[model samples]
Target: MTNVREAALDVIEKINKNQAYSNLLLNETINKHKLIRKDIGLLTEIVYGTIQRQKTLDFYLDDFLTNRKKIQPWVISLLHLSLYQMIYLDRVPDRAVIHEAVEIAKKRGHKGITGMVNGVLRNVQRKGLKDFSSISDSAERVSIEKSHPLWLVKRWIEQFGLAETEAMCEENLQAPYVTARVNTMKTTVEQVLHELSEAGLDVIKGDLSEDAIKVIQGHLIETDVYKSGEVTIQDESSMLVARALDVESGQAILDACAAPGGKTTHIAERLQGEGYVQSLDLHEHKIKLIKKQAERLGLTNVEAMALDSRLVTDKFEENSFDRVLVDAPCTGFGVLRRKPDIKWSKKPEDVERITSVQWGILDSQASLVKPGGKLVYSTCTIEEAENQEIVAAFLKDHPEFSMDNTMIERLPNGVEPYVDGGELQLLPHYFGTDGFYIATLIKDS
Candidate 1:
């Protein structure tokens, strides 16, 4: 039997040294090992836990290394995995982790390096962790508490005040809940819940959206209901965007930036094959993703296209669509639970650059809505510049459009009053969903 710890070490090395995404590398390695269900769980935990707490692990390592010579990336990765098991997995004894690390080091490195590895880890075990209070910087404290990069922590502190920033950081550390939207067109929520329960799955009703079901302790992907396209995995916050659009049957809808077709499929399902849903994204590959989803959901009204929404006026007549959804891309600070590495990878300036692009897309797509038609602007981000400020600025420039408060009434249940001048903002910690923002606008006749 291959050592599951060794496999995790290999995947961690690829993530840190080779600069690969943690999820992608984990999936690839798991498939390659052909591991049993239990080993697969262990391998996933070790890899993700090590990467997620890398900053804390490195801080612990500082106590052990005397000279702190530049260690090779793979050795550092191996040490991280060993330390993670020693500290986090109480079932795995410390001596066993040390033994495995020493053995792996000896096999992969020279005798002296193996000795160094053993000595350093043992010293850390003895010295315990260093306190961050000594640093005396608020940003540094936030970084240690949240395991976030100092720059990001500093930015949040400046933008959201210390207490709220700390809360946001703490929220990001929790494991994300598995939320899925029932395809009402294919099966009712009651039918899906009954079928899932019969299959020995543990699921609970979602708090915010009636159509959403939160998976408590089962892999819904393995269930026939999910595989057969009776449900689609989407966040409760995301499910609100489609419902907020208040789509009607026999209307012509344009989903700008639609890829992987989550919202597009939801719109089609709501329309019940009465409306024509044109799903357009910039990439040809993404067009296939939309097509595949439509095929799976048995949706006939969605037409997938590979065209830029920003240049829609050149291709389609003005006032062409009854409703247009511009789910513009932004720095995804909202879904950090799924993409932890983004905390380390993103720069502060990235926000401004991405917001600029979002503005252009919003401006271009707003023209596609017919006079008296509705337009929805949404993003999976909590940043004000990407959410409220974007919509506020758009309304100032366009006199023909006005806010629609009635759209909020159509949202899923328990969604608090996040509406401000027709926009809705959903914070992750508050909504138990990814941070999301939505605004509905109607063109004045």
Candidate 2:
């Protein structure tokens, strides 16, 4: 049997030392260690819980710790893992957690270090952590309480008010339900839900999006329904991208920066296998991922190719495609619940850098939309810089395109209230989806 605690320790250490993404590292470690399903669950809880609660864990650890300077990096990871179980996991006995931490520390270090780990943890358990409720600063308190970086919390506070930022950060700590989009090209949403339920998985029709289904139980990707290409695992927020495009049969579309094409396939599905979707990405390997999705969904209308989105004009004639999508990559702050490592991986400067790229990509792809056609610019980020500001900047330079208010009718009915000036910014707390931004523009005839 794999040593589950030791496996958790290895994952935590590697993540901190190698700057590895927690989700990918945990998955790879579980596979490499050949952990059973039960152990895999435990390891996942340890690694992700610790990362999601790192700021708060350190806050508690700092109170009991006499000398933080002497603590080794691995020891810090070990303590973080231990405290995550003790605080968050109710079913795991507290004593069992402490004992495992001691044993892991002893295995990795000398007796002195193990004694320090035991003492600090026990001291925290006995005396309890420092009272953060008494802290006077609201932003700092929220940052520590929600376990988000102070900079990020303050930035969000600046953009969104205190209560909203607090809610967003708190929601970011919660696990998101597995959402999948039904391949309506081959099956209806009701049929897919019936098939999934009959197959012994607990699921429900999604509250948002016409074709989205939530997997309440079972690994969605492992289900036979998925293997049969009846559904594709995607967030409901992402599923809205195709609807935002509102592609029709035989209308050419361009998905600039499309890789692992979720929206691209959705466009092909909407096209009824008649229209061609030029899915472009800078990397050849990622382009393969787009092709793989197209193949899985039996979509023949998508053509995946390696090309830079900034140079779209170099690859094709201007005003050639009827619709275009620029899902510009941002800091990914919106999907923190699914990938907690993103919160720590990004910096304030990254938003600025990506904003520049988003602006460039939107302008470059704008010409591809033929006269009287539409273009949709989107990102899975809640930042105004990448979403509204980019669109605002684009509008100033190009007067031929105007905000398409009719696109609001294309969105999910319940989401119409959020659309203003032909743009929508979905917050995770307010909208039960990944925080996203969508802006639709139409070229004049």
Candidate 3:
């Protein structure tokens, strides 16, 4: 208990003071301390669960802080972490949570602070979060209840309406399943499933993609299929990007924002070892990542280099490739389930900034497509300004490119519910997959 509490506090402090990412810090700190598996699970549960529910926990704690007591940051963090366990973790006994929190306070604080910590948690145990009906404004109340920023909630209400916004926020707090794409270039999904089953791994076929498999449990990279480049751990929604491009054998393709090479490798796999795929990225280090993935997958069709997609016209000739894919950078609000901290880390202004950047990359890469070629612009974001609005604005200026009506036919069957005409915004709550925005465009000859 002591080690778990201490480790969680260390991660919380770093995330607060240094702005360290919660996932990276948790993995690093846990390995650094060499904590056992049980303690590791406890520490991870408390850290993510507390951070995910920080706002709601603080809202509940506000009632117990009756005298306007100015508690230290560490003390507040302790209370928040402990209250998360009490409110959300039903398997955890309330008495044990309060006792562990009080104990943590004593070890980390003085006698006076320890007493206050014990008092606050006990009062919380006695009375749960009172009616949020007092929060008058609908968006504000939903924000607190779902542990999301009020500004974000307000923005979402305007875009998605009340019901869907609430559902999306609630889904962000749930654990996401692990999905991996089988390298269909090397082996079929059926053969991979058979191999995984033989290896004693619990796995199942993905919902949408014929090539993607969802891991029910266990680390995939440790298994022989992954080590041998038979499977790559990628989200189901992400697998749709390469398919959206609909690349064929001997077709030249450009992956404008290829990095860490999930989609780039998928594109290469789709090519079936013919033609060329110039995987361009902004950084040399990330380009190396693409090269590494290409090598691991035994793909020779990919060529990775540090070429900024925003400067695509500057580096490459106009109408150079048969197809271009811009998986644009975004505020990443859509992937909150995989990265809950993004909700707190991002600001409203960031949406405008990234939208501008998305437009710039789109503008530059639009010229890279050959006449009669296709350009697929996609983002793992659900925001209107970044997703639909960005493409709408671009198409307003560039009449040469029109929405690919065939996009609807290209999507896997169960994806029709989320598909909007030719473009689709995969909602987290609706599809049970990572939120992704994929729009296919064809340049008129």
Candidate 4:
């Protein structure tokens, strides 16, 4: 059997070096080693847990290393893996955790390194962990406690205040909820619920969107319902985009920046095979992903193309569509629960950089909306600069368009507090949803 702990260490090492994404690398290692179901679960937990709590783990480990400069990089990863299991995993006995870590160290390094690994693990087991209360600065305290970058925590605290930022950061540490949108054209939520329940999965209708379902237990992807295209895995917050677009049958729609077509397919499904959605992406390969998703959901009304959204007017006429969606890209701070590495991968400068691209996409897609038609600008980020500020900038530049407040009527109830005027910023802690932003705008007739 593959040593799950060692596999986790390998994945974490690559992640630290910026060599591979944690999820992709973990999946590749699992396949290469042919790990069993139990091992797969353990490996995934350790890899994600270590990366998720890397800062906090390091803060504790700092106390034990006498000369940290001398420790091998791989040894640090090994210690993080072991400490993550010891501290967070109640089911794992310290003796077994330390034993496996030492064995892996012995195989990978010399006697001196092995002794160091054994000593650190044993010390942490005996000494417990360092205290966060010692950190006097509130932002720094929250940053280390929640395992996020200090800069990010400070920015969030500045934008959202200390209490809300701390809450959002704490929420990011939890496991992401698995929710899927029912393909209304292919099946109803009730029908899919019955089908999933019969297959022995713990499933429930989503609390937010009527068309969403939450998978509480069992793997939905391995089931026939998902494989046969009756459902597509998407966050409930994301499923709100099509509804906010207020799609109608026989109305032409454009989905700018629509790769891997989640919202694009939702809009197409709502069209019920009547109207076509023109989807665009910068990369040809990602355009293929959008096409594949449309095909899988048996959606006939989606036409995907490879083109930069900034050059969209080069191909289509202005005022061309009844409704348009610019799900513009951002830093993706709102999805930290699923992509914890994002906390480490993204620098503060990245926010300033990506907002410019977002502004460009929103500007280009604005011209495509027919006069009196609706346009929705959305992103999976909580940053005001990327969310509300971008929308504010677009409205200022294009006086012909105005915020469409009727989106509240189209969305699910209980979202009014989040919706300021026509824009909604759904923070991760708000509804246990991914941090998402959506704004509905209308072109003047």
- Candidates' TM-scores? 0.94, 0.98, 0.95, 0.98
User: lDDT tens digits, residues 70-172, model 1?
Assistant: 7788888888889988888898888888998998898889998899889988887887777777778888877875688888777777766898777877787
lDDT at residue 397 of model 3 (Cα atoms): 90
Cα RMSD to the true fold for all candidates: 2.0, 1.2, 1.7, 1.2
Tens-digit per-residue lDDT, 237-331, candidate 4:
99999999999999999999897899999999999889799999899999999989988899889999999899988999988999999998888
In terms of lDDT, the best-performing candidate is: 4
Could you tell me which residue pairs clash in candidate 2? none
Q: Clashes in each model (backbone N, CA, C under 3 Å)?
A: 0, 0, 0, 0
Of 1 and 3, the candidate ranking higher by lDDT: 3
**TM-score between model 1 and native:** 0.94
lDDT of candidates 1 onward, in order? 0.84, 0.88, 0.88, 0.91
In model 1, state the lDDT of residue 105: 90
C-alpha lDDT (0 to 100) for residue 318 of candidate 1: 89
Q: Clashes in model 1: which pairs?
A: none
> Model 4, which residues run further than 4 Å from truth?
none
What is the per-residue lDDT of model 2 for residues 326-356, given as tens digits with 9 covering 90 to 100?
9998889999998888888788999999998
Candidate 2 lands at a TM-score of 0.98
Q: Cα RMSD (Å) between model 4 and the true structure?
A: 1.2
